[model samples]
Target: MPTDLVTTAGQAAGRVADALAGLDLAGPVRDLAAALPGGRTATLAARPGWAELAALGGRARRHSDALDAAARAYLDAEAAARAAAGPA
Candidate 1:
């Protein structure tokens, strides 16, 4: 897929993950857990999947940049070769 698409998808996934995590986990389980010893210390972090997707998007962008550079180099070389070969 295009790097742009990958980036957009990554951003969307990250937003969704953040929204999911933002939800309150109250009720019995939360109460029970909080009733335990160190439940108050229990904190949730960002999901690994969203992070991985974001990383992938960054990687794709880098790869795309590299690919563009290589293509330009190839075209330049081809143009040079054609010029060296004289009219035709």
Candidate 2:
């Protein structure tokens, strides 16, 4: 794949990861839970939701890192190839 495409994909993934990281779901949930009567209900509502959000963010970050690595590898390969060709 082209370096530009890979780099752009990486950037997009990074943005997604950033957006997910910025989420304040827990605070809202905690506030809402506090308004409610029971601790168990709050725990049930909060844990799985945040876990899934965290997992999604992790996946986006990993994807961004992989794309960045691929872009770097491609650039390195191109540079090496050009160096091997030498003065052409």
Best by TM-score: 2
Q: In model 1, how large is the Cα lDDT of residue 86?
A: 100
**Residue 17 of model 2, lDDT score:** 97
lDDT of 1 by residue, 1-88 (tens): 2544544555565555555544443443445545664545333222123234445545655555555555566667778889999998
Instruction: Give the TM-score comparing model 2 with the true structure, all chains together.
Output: 0.75
What ranges in model 2 sit over 4 Å off?
38-47
For model 1, name the residue pairs that clash.
Answer: none
Could you tell me every candidate's TM-score relative to the true structure?
0.45, 0.75
What's the lDDT for residue 63 in model 1?
Answer: 58
Clash pairs for candidate 2: none
Q: Residue 82 in model 2: shift from native, Å? A: 1.4
Candidate 2 local accuracy as lDDT?
0.83
Could you tell me how far off, in angstroms, the CA of residue 81 lies in candidate 1 after the best superposition?
0.2
